[model samples]
Target: MPSALLPIIAWDYQFAPNAQKSRNYLYITHTPFKICEQPFLLPRPALLSLGITYRRVPVLSIGKDVFCDNASFLDAMQELLEREGEGRALKRGGADRAFEAWGYRSFWVALASVPAGLVSKELGEDRRELFRRF
Candidate 1:
């Protein structure tokens, strides 16, 4: 079974770093997939339909199975690669974890540094509501 025949869907906000990370990982592994770009605000109907209430981007859906969060997403991708006999193409370890943590911290810092004037009021309110629990 060729990888392209499988339905791999990645859901994320437009220009999201997490989504970009997923794309890079897939590209490096020669995985063929599609991305469903979403809006920054709420009402993500596709994700809601999948029963994913978590407010985050880079959600990966392979067939009926969905992998949310970076860890699970990477694990699933690795599994897929292994199943396809491409296991040796990429290796995972503590370095990946450290990079993920650093990337997330940097992402937050960059987001925080964005000028208020450059961001719309609705986006600001949306993010505040979404990340209120954090």
Candidate 2:
């Protein structure tokens, strides 16, 4: 008999491309999952409740396990698919790495290009506080 599949939850901010990337990956891989969008401010209650200290979007929650960071989340998703005999979804090669690098660079560039007037002062402060270490 086959084992039961657990629910997969993706936590991220609305309009986040990284979140969309995860969703698109799941869709392409034919994996069923749900998304939970977080508010664009500090004190993400849901993440805090999940014991997640990382201040970033695109967190994956599979059953009781929480995966933070894109690399780990993709790795976990790939492993899950493999265990279910779905095969690897991501190609491991120089092209894949280049694409990932481009994606990340573009994401930052897009974010930085957002007009200051379009962002609220509170949101700006929250983002600064979140990424102060970096």
Each candidate's lDDT (Cα)? Answer: 0.75, 0.74
Model 2 C-alpha lDDT per residue in residues 39-113, reported as the tens digit of each score: 766678988886787888888877777877777777787777776674646656668768999988887767766
Taking all chains together, each candidate's TM-score versus the true structure is 0.81, 0.80
TM-score of 1: 0.81
In model 1, the runs with Cα more than 4 Å from the true position are: 1-6, 130-134
lDDT of 1 by residue, 2-117 (tens): 35656788899758777888778878887778888776778788888867887778788777778777678778768777777845348877798898788878877776666668
Deviation in angstroms for 15 in model 1?
A: 0.2
Candidate 1 has an lDDT of 0.75
